[model samples]
Target: MTTLQGKTALVTGASAGIGLATARMLSHAGARVICCARALERLQIQLDEMPGPGLAVELDVADAVSAASLPDRLPQDWQAVDILVNNAGSDIGGRQPFHEGDINQWAGTIQTNVTGLMQVTAAMLPGMLAREQGHIVNIGSTQGLTPVAGCGAYTAS
Candidate 1:
């Protein structure tokens, strides 16, 4: 059990699934947790249920403007993140082959999973490097390694 007392953790896509679970675990371990998601109401509910200190921020990582402004939007106390969990991702478009899929959906998937992740990492990296202490955890899917039929965009992302 790694103790994270006095540390702060930021988790994206924290409105549900693995992101929510990670936020709970980090909070239980004594880290102040900041949950980021597009749905502020749901995020707040999750934060309220978690142990220790927690905050909820509405963020859409897929949106370049939103991603770029995230660092500036953080409250002073939560700005210096000790742990970053890049878990904001989704499979867009219905199950379909690459050629049959919606191009917009494919672009969205890429923007969120790749470009958005990079933006968030870049936004937070400077603070981490300056402090000389931090950890970044990128959540990846087995689908990325083992391509599955009808999930071309998701697999590619």
Candidate 2:
């Protein structure tokens, strides 16, 4: 197994599910993990449970300003992230035909999954490039490829 001793990892949407699991794994691997999510309370709970050092930051990736400001907002010790997990996403507005779907729902999905991902990556990439070593992991669903009828908005994102 690859050991991440002394490395710092940032995981978005890390209050639950896969993001939370990944944070734990990274912590176990000896990386200091920074967990970001809108649910600050939950994130703090998870961070407290981590076997290694962890920090919890409240964030809403769907907001352009928030996503873009992530790097600058991190504590100095956690700013040079060696690993980034772009795992924040949403599936609102339930299943419905594309034409019948709510425009707002579609917009929300796009904002979170597409635009937010881009903003976060742009904010973090410069630092990684300058350092010449870093890893970015983008979590995506199989729905992106299958494109089920009622989930067009999600698939498109």
Candidate 3:
């Protein structure tokens, strides 16, 4: 296993599923993790389970205002993040045909999966660039590669 001693990682959508698993793995690998999600309570609970140091941060990646302010909002010690995992995603319209899908839901999906990912990357990239030693990992679904019916917004993202 590759050790990440003395490094810090930030994971979006970390309250559950893949995000949570990634955060736990990073912590176990020796990186201090910042677990971010819309649900602070759940995030905190997950953070407490990590084998290493971590912090739970409330964040809605779809909210540009919050995404833009994330870097500054982090504690000074956690500010110099060395790894970023852009894993927040949404499929608000579910598996509905395009014509039958709700436009509002489609918009929400786009905002979270595409725009939100970019927003979070933008917020973290500057620090990584300044430090000149960092890595970014973007988790994408198979839907992005193989077009599927009834998941227009998700596939597009």
- In model 3, the runs with Cα more than 4 Å from the true position are none
TM-scores, each model vs. reference: 0.96, 0.95, 0.97
Choose the strongest candidate by lDDT.
Answer: 3
Number of the top candidate by TM-score? 3
Q: Clashes per prediction? A: 0, 0, 0
lDDT of 3 by residue, 1-157 (tens): 8999999999999999999999999999999999999999999888878999999999999999999999999999999999999999988969987779998999999999999999999999999999898999999999999988999999999
RMSD of 3: 0.8
Error of 1 at 97 (Å): 2.5
lDDT of each: 0.91, 0.91, 0.94
Q: Which residue pairs overlap in candidate 2's backbone?
A: none
Please give, for residues 41-79, the per-residue lDDT of candidate 2 as tens digits: 999889889999999988888988888888889988789
In model 1, pairs of residues that clash are none
* Per-residue C-alpha lDDT of model 1 across residues 34-152, encoded as one tens digit per residue: 99999999998888898799989988988878877887899998999999999999888858867788889989899999898998898889999999999999998899899899988
User: Per-residue lDDT for 56 in model 3?
Assistant: 91
Compute the lDDT for candidate 2: 0.91
